[model samples]
Target: MSLAWNASTDNVGVTGYGVYRGGTLVTTVTGTSFTDTGLSAGTAYTYTVRARDAAGNQSANSNQITATTSGGGGDTTAPSVPGNLRSTGVSSSSVSLAWNASTDNVGVTGYGVYRGGTLVTTVTGTSFTDTGLSAGTAYTYTVRARDAAGNQSANSNQITATTTTGGGGGGKKVLGYFVQWGVYQRAYHVKNIDTSGSAAKLTHINYAFGNVQNGQCTIGDSNADYDRFYSAAESVDGVADTWDAGALRGNFNQLRKLKQKYPNLKVLFSFGGWTWSGGFGQAAANPAAFAESCYRLVEDPRWADVFDGIDIDWEYPNACGLTCDTSGPASFRNLMSALRARFGSGNLVTAAITADGTSGGKIDAADYGGAAQYLDWYNVMTYDYFGAWAAQGPTAPHSPLTSYTGIPQAGFHSDQAIQKLKSKGVPASKLLLGIGFYGRGWTGVTQSAPGGTATGPAPGTFEQGIEDYKVLKTRCPATGTIAGTAYAHCGNQWWSYDTPSTIGGKMGYSKDQGLGGAFFWELSGDTTNGELITAMRNGLG
Candidate 1:
């Protein structure tokens, strides 16, 4: 049973809450909620809560609540075998599977998922996502049905899945962007990746916004990168940093700890997002020098072990972003060639390129196809095609997977971007579809559907028109789905974002296109439990 109560205040500030069961002290927690397990079946219990302070002063018990656990029964008949078991998706660290339902004399209760003949987990559904496996490895799987009586059926047909190679080569890659500024305002830390259960499902992490200035790579925030200290509670390994001379601290130290925990997971330093692409022209002017500087910085002894390679996020080479660039079509290829030559074949080299599929648009403004030869794969930024940046109405999904009727612009959708890149001679295997973890919306709208006129951008936590999935999942609640994505409208507000269901569909499309895998805009926008990334892992399996 789970119990929760309103918080109480103290003169010196409340420290923690104490939970009680039937007039007896149970356990205490720092949060407002607690879950009690190992209770008797079909038995009722009463609970109460009290607040405590640092001085050990306790407040009066609050109102009491009663709850009961579900009863369990016994039967002997076993369930029939689950039929037609098969692998649905495979990634660097996990495998997704599905099977037909089984029949039982007293009704089937659950299905047991097995890896290498060992029972891994029991689930009520027909599908399961098995994670924490090694990269570039092969494993076999099977399933069996269980009944209310605890009777299990025979194992279903066995199947095998091989995880992607190291560094996300030649297979599906589940990469997520971790922003440096997230620790300040968002309160998202490297520890959240482990607590939210995202570390085991990820193949790679892109540390965003490594600066590009004066034709050389630079740290975006030295304080956030390696100076800020973390306490024991804030550390990923539960060991605080010491203030000793030359001790590594902040996100860099935390990332090192995370890498120690997840050996197969790779980290890449990403440079030149929308706000910093202006320096690309200077870097392009001296490609060899720029590559040399980047190699030196990435290989700096202070934190050289934290990264596997480097990812270029130049918004749009030879085109427009916050500031337009006329560095010519060959600049992108030249820069990538220099990086490859300097980094050698041991380190991975990748880039995030424009998904503008429009003829003579951003895609045509650079030589992405010519540059593909020097890279392992490309993170196709397929999102942010439209949003409230247009402000006054004409609501549309920011990350539509396919073009739908009445779309604001032709060739702006994901499929169009993918086909255009392929037509430009870019290999499908080197393309990774992008999914946004947030949404874009508009307010003062009467119609709840797309194409409705709006007054302006909708209210959001940080920015007007943009919100995270954790907020939108409950705030607006998706009223409908369109163009392979989801949208919601509550009162005058209209928002569009991807739910787990929609991400599954997108992953299916990625597999159909023979693409590398899926990646998202960021990790902070996800729920506390990491719902979006979980869906991405399961969908790609």
Candidate 2:
């Protein structure tokens, strides 16, 4: 078929055209245009089409049309350089790098990541993780955008990031679990942690509270009566009196001493637990008074230097805890806003929340997503899905990684809890995975590992409940793996606890999901050598 030009712009009424390549005429046609076939692959050909009239007069060629045949479409443009590069506050052996999305003319398909002038990875993502680098070493990175046509854009501005010093060998994310004091004293149950090895792996040691009592801070010695109100109720089925100021100062002084010993540790006073959560509704009602009381309690001149931040552990507001508070969800956001304004940005504010992944759980608790904007991180209490309370025919997994064939609760697993929070717009980096140092079990079991049943609640030392993970790891080992978690049965007792192998699996999941890190209930429950903690740290690597 003869090629026809749409229109002729030259001085000649084009009758025919000559197609020339590299100073040689490739074809001549009677029509205004000609098509040249049989072009070699990957070969560059410069062509000019000259129009000739019926008088044999020719016109200068239109702008030269230089085309290159392709073996395949090769990308010539490098990726757009990454922008808004930032470094994390506490660096470890390896550093995380993230940037804004790159742009391309043909639609960006992926990215070529470079570290210190060397290509590290070609990721189809805006972020790339660089591992195996020396701690405290500085790294310079540049990213380029790749289009569908395989062409890449020029490199964007180079951004530099530095790794932190003194991580435990490999590029593991080090998360130090700060045990809330008094929950586990220096006893074998939750106390004996190996301080020597902990220093190298730990990034922060969080001391539970500075104020005593389950909830209230006794103003004076008269408050001694309220010291163990909740624990007393558990023992003596009676309601305890409020704040007897007598023992308040002594407990504060004791906290001061503990802080003196661990200077590098961060002491955070956590207010509100299961029993003491009643006052939060009232406190949350009056944001100004609550903020004032918190400031005075945490910032007391005597222990001002001792505390680094304040953690709000309101068990459940507007929902049921040991008691229920009707202070609507907005109350939580208001309280946190006042606290953030009063405490300013320097102090850290965090909260412990239930892992109930249902709509009721979200409404029962205050505005967690709203509060997230004010707080640094939201710690999801992922454990305690199944416990002695569910004393029944079919046994349940306490801290299941995923939903199994017969999970006790429909979406009560750790994975569900985390995903629920993420779906609410809470960044993964700001969410801390909760790990229980204790295990929940039942007596009169039948099935073997991970899938056994008990007729009643398992007996504990002080309470007829759960035992620490340290004890269960040795006492009862799992026979089978359940959703990357473990459970076992020995004799008439069924136990569930995370082993090093299972922990390793969970850690991989956490990293793949881009989570911040893991935190356990109390430190004292770990082995003297900190074996479980080490497993968590190493697994994070």
Candidate 3:
């Protein structure tokens, strides 16, 4: 038979290629490419080709080729790491990135790009474009090169990029509450009130009720509760809490103290929460009296000069809250109109409304959109949408962005509430996103992640199913994002809450949606160092 060699260089003429089995030379073939027959199936073989001359001289062996006659091929070498990763273009909605080519021992196949720990795209080329991102969003990206054998290289150095802030300047602003529930004042309650650190990164502080009189609404008293409350109140305004003492004389003095302590801070008096909602109906019944009562309560001659504004937390005006109110929607408008008429534009006027986005729950309860015209901002209580009230099933998301498959509730997400308010003609710039200081979770969840249902809300130390952000961030770090929100899970226990990373994303969403800003439930729930609040401040910036 004629002998041949595959591109072999030698002094000898091409003769044949040697096929080896178990390190032993088996047969010699004339053709450069030989199909060895009569070989056992699924056996390993090592082959090397050599050139032989007509004079019977054999040359040294060529490169060795090892093959496992099995069902599939195997690759032992990994692809190269992608290089020169750089952002090509950036915008509010998209970012384009490019990288240098990667080489593998066998061959390079493709590259994968990750944004903020998410696998954004896989491309066969060196560049990939990621879109559908929120404006003003900060993204960290990494690239990996893959080979045909499915071998992947280690990720390249991460590249951080941020989207544009956009041209439309108006966005939402959140007004957080500073509920001084008589804890920070008394040395005993001071133990309960954790001021071991500085104040949280909050835009506004609505100091809880300034009322101190035992029955007559007087300010200063020797009683412990009365004394602590009065002193605390007075410290904020730099004057004694003198009740029945005109606006500027009493509360205004406290305002001055607070202003002096936090020069950049804005102080607003929250009229009625759950405890004080009873008087709202009567106040709503008579708009002038309601306005006058608030005017006197807020603008008391003792310290009227110090207060910058008033915040009405009526719980629910037309709808039942801590107490039921028969007054209709128009009554809320009347009360707000009176307040606006009395306080005028120079003073800030805002309200904390229910998070219920249902037509009847919030819209029918009061003409909130109509009242918006009379106020500078409206705080949408975007939490407490779900709890242990419903029948036992999946532990629902307290603040969902949109409806998704298998979602227990149809319209209970934060996005739905905001959209509902906007549909009612409220401007996005005046709407503040409400974030809960705590997380609601359920125990006995068999699934590993957020969408799974729990037997019921899990038990908590202080409260059932609700834990502060400080605890949850350490207990359950959010790992996934759904509809722009973040959630996490641990064996049989699932928690849905926001982290700094998630908050950053939400801040981008707020900027993209033209919303004002963010507002958390309260300051005390945050960590002593105010880590979460710092994230909010930096994320907003």
Candidate 4:
């Protein structure tokens, strides 16, 4: 049998070639080709070639090639072909591939690699690392294995991969949320992104609530995603959204434009919110199908380029949020693992999780630690622990950073939640402390401090008990601080929310804790000057 391949290079140059039959070193040559004699006439054999430098450092084995003789042989059976080939890590200049090991009657010896239809190299292991490739190039790969008896197997499944354009979303990871419904009643157009200076500071944005339904990921609002047209004034650059040929019209197109100006800002389509979380239980039952549907939806051709990945926001896993979930304790872990496998290594996968840090509370409801391996990071919702949901009487700051004396609930503050999550083996670098850009308040309050008496939810401009920071700062001028958050009393109404000062303090704690970064509930709640966001960015630095 004879085998030939392109030469491998080192710091110096290729000096010679070493050939192997099955697993044993057979012969050495100073040329790129090799030939073997004295084999049985009717038998099968496998061969791999390796290059050696003048210094005697041997290169990895070359791609395996098999041949069968016309007569008989002592041990002529070939090993089974490699299977389950997939790409794991990838970058502009390199790609990493792995596969299931092949089995053989006489034991598999080595595996051969091929890239772009040409023999690249061979390896004794089941994985190969292809390096020194061009950036932004598309490559296809396959592998084969040989038995110790010198019998070669056929090619494995082919895998197509492309080098990433750049790298993973890096830097300090200043993530922010962009609410889809804000475009409607809130009138927070995508143009506000530029006006508020959010596009410049943000490294990634989560497009909120894509909606999980009927065990599949779906868009929360079709009109808001791709159909809502922007007027010339409302558009980011003062240009009207066109209905021209192949023109996209909604938030998706606007985000695409925002990313054009701020190329570093990656966006992920976040599916599921408090209202849409009921379907997550159903999703966990068939996670692979759910992941595939989500991948297709996120990569939809019309505005595929707008998003970098997907975010799973199951309100509570194995626990109750808006609806109860009976999916076992391992459900969240299984669901997330499937998502990571299906999404592959090229894109980011994240989740927005609950922050109930009390003993046997929301934190104990799911396997967040097990799921952490699959996530880029988690947005710890550190707010909403207390609000008008309980109705009358005691009023407390909804977003307390610390557990203050006389606090109504234990482990209901931001610091408690963050520390609890970190204790569960979640790296602080993979936890983004959540901040609310608005205030939660109560009406009919007499005392100015937190824990004041109140009748019911306050009369918000839009919602009953919630109002934007811009409005709350002036209307309910903060008169006191409790648990590291601000509160105020104006007439008979009382409200508690984070001001710029409190936000600075929170960001400082986030830095001190070595967190990934801070992510707020939304972008629209800040002042027109981007007050809270500016404080967060500077404090993080």
Candidate 5:
């Protein structure tokens, strides 16, 4: 019998609900609903519910209700064996599986997903994601259909899959953003990541900046995303793109090849960015419609296998960013719930969130903690705390790991941001420290120390006051270290950024803090030999 009850509130918070059968506890569930099987026909069962918290406090029992099974002899025949069990996707700590359903004399109650012959979990849905698994491990899986009368079908055909090298909450995640426009003036191609040895050390890549417009997820750049042709030399593999009608090309095709070379890496389509976050308000107003549109795009058949999931990069849910949103604090959680419902457990759902740690700031402007239940993890954008945007003076590091004596603002550092989110009930394991693979600078700085006054933003290759680590590592090497980062002043050009040595220090902090992993803003900023990524991999170990 399926049972549900209204949620009970608590001062701290209700962790779960305990369902009592005949005045005795039967089972506990986090959600308000429960399903009980294996009852005799025509029998009435009395049930009551009590709410519970993490500290073991329980609420008084609710009013009792009774439910009776149908008036008939108990079902005896088992369901047919489930057919064609298969693995849909594999990650470092999870496997997505699906199978054909089985019919029974009565009705199919649920499907039992088993791993290595052990019953893992039972779900009413046709698909499930087995999580909390070890990295680089192989596990065989099978499924069995269950009927209401307690009869279980024979095991379905078994399949095996190996997990990726690094993923999940247990392993260190190294995710880097691959900007779609990097192929233009940046002169960085997807193949360069492979040739530079960055791909092997990375666990996941976020294809940045898919647009969110008209309450839908749309392609950001057609040519750079999939239309541009690549020669054999520019391809991750030695194969060149052909003019064949359906031939895949561009970054999408190259990423597919990169995955073939490194089976452990997962890729996600990330929508929204600082400049394109304006459409998020409309998305928040109608989350279900937005999620449906995103689902269709991410699961499109043309390049269905190219992505494993979607990453939302809403700059601020109910606060100000490139544009302001007034959808209220609950909007973020509602949007995430919609996405999770549409994508199901078989696909990863994550988001890139703001790191504004100030009290009553952006962090407190949304229900991020409430939304945590739906996200696989969160990419905490811990950078951009202070930068050339300040323009004239008081130049500070764009990504500070900790507070300092003369800090420009309190709670504007990476540690503060992570702690603030944790205080709001977001698990530390779900947080990824953000790193900038570039430097922010100010020109006309006289003093050698960080507090020196500056005239304006320094000139850069692409944009003023910002330069890639590849250029800064050589052009303006580190001269001092502060707040767990590096800074340099060369010929009136004052710059601050993360070096390999500083990254090692930050990684130690990541381990000490029990963080999930670290992610960088972009890939093109690193050295041609992937010096920064190498440091990140070694440091995580």
Candidate 6:
């Protein structure tokens, strides 16, 4: 038999392809085509292919095709059902699944593992680690085997696994963002965090927008930062801020009390967001002074007890965010090193990074790997790969786990950027996958799938082309999913966002890839009941 198809391409060229027949892997060849002999005539064969590059990154399986021999005198019997399927162990985020091997007339190719009756993935081995499960949740798993002639066995005995209760234990973490501007029109205050039940679910909360100004970390909004008074009704614990001598007030005070309530919750003052990133270039010029200013401000005596650490959110060290920064590549490493030195090893030092997932993209413009040692772990802003920025958009999901066929751009997917970072020597355990708490859409979308023509940006509640997941979940509701993200098209609008189910898939991907954890853009984007955040915690736990 002979097979040939179009060649697969990678940013770093494809190294080889794995050819599979039924459950058996036939061969891994470097060429685009493969030929096989010794097959009996008149037998049916199912084939699929997977491409891998030098970096050890494998592409998703290709479309399956069928071929038949003329004689039909080959082994046509299916493999026996895999037996003794059992759960070896379970953790907050993962379950260990194993089963006895099956016998086939010819040879068993591999096994298919299912979770809750859905085929989550396929493996050549007898055991699989199902990751990104909610802690304390029960799950059912089954396995089946296949023969070379395209015959599949019956499902194995199902076993239930009850994951242990806990968040990502040890140094692993689940972090969330609480925006400073959320208090304005959004009416989402630090108090809302308690009401939403997010405080208990989070390990850390980044109080965003400690702006970078004049090459130093400074308060972005005085009124919202520590001046605005919260009424008794707006307070987190139902207690009002006092106006006595040496009285602590505003959101800063509320956050302090919140920490007291949730002993393990660490709040970090995040510096330099999209709008306030213009000062990063100046700060990079003198790393020490920048670090010193941050230390003093973050450790201010008035709110010293409030913040556990400093989170540098410089939009881009050597690239661009709100404004362009021409700082050299070495600047990011220098800034982070200085901050780490000043903050000391005991404090939690972190950074929110860019996820420009293209080859020679913004990620290549900075020295993240060199600076990884200085950070607890990087918050890889993996979302925002595509949006309705182009008035006439070839619509695509903002956060795609892998590139799909006919994708608009190359290297603009999550897995590619992640694989690039991994190839650049950034440890997977030090990288946290980013999830957007919102969706990007375009109006006048005629077709639903990606690469469809669109007229202009979709109308959003806050900004054009963007809307909260909470709103999109109801307004449009995901009609289809691709590359592990959810999308919906209602009337003239086409929206793409991560739903709970999609988030679960991403969480599984994170676990399989050995990522540290997952974090979203902001908390207010979730439902009032915290459904999305709950999904994240459940998947990552």
Lowest summed lDDT window (length 10), candidate 3: 212-221
Which candidate tops TM-score? 6
Tens digit of lDDT per residue, candidate 1, span 244-312?
998999898999999999999999999989988889999999999999999998889989999999999
lDDT of each: 0.85, 0.63, 0.63, 0.81, 0.85, 0.82
Alpha-carbon RMSD of each model: 18.5, 20.0, 19.9, 21.5, 18.9, 12.2
> What residue pairs are clashing in model 4?
41-71, 42-70, 42-71, 42-72, 45-150, 46-150, 61-122, 62-122, 64-112
Candidate 4 lands at a TM-score of 0.68
Model 1 bad stretches (over 4 Å): 1-170
Candidate 4, 167: how far from true, in Å?
26
Error of 2 at 468 (Å): 1.2
Better of 3 and 6 by TM-score: 6
lDDT of 3 at 355: 74
Instruction: Write candidate 5's Cα lDDT for 305-357 as tens digits.
Output: 98999999998888888888898889999999999999999998999999998
lDDT (10s digit) by residue, model 3, range 160-272: 87876774333534455655543433222222122433233455766554331221112221133232334543353334454552323322344455456667667787767
Which ranges of candidate 4 are over 4 A from the true structure?
A: 1-171
* Cα-lDDT of candidate 3: 0.63
Ranked candidates (lDDT, high to low): 1, 5, 6, 4, 3, 2
TM-score of model 2 (CA atoms): 0.60
Please provide, for model 2 over 1-541, each residue's C-alpha lDDT reduced to its tens digit, 9 standing for 90 to 100.
Answer: 1133443444534445676777677655543444444345567878777777647888777666677766755545544655665432224445555566777655776666777766565655454456556777788988776666556666768878776566432223444444333333443211123243554455545545333242234232222212433332222122232355543332333334444554554556666666567777777667877887788877877557656677777778778778777888798889889888888898987777878875457533667766779887777788888887878536766888766545666677886677656555566667777777777889988877444556888887555658877677777767555656777787888877777777776776566555677767767566667777787888877
Which lDDT tens digits does candidate 4 get at residues 389-439? 767848888998876545778668887676666656676678888889999
Ranking by TM-score: 6, 1, 5, 4, 3, 2
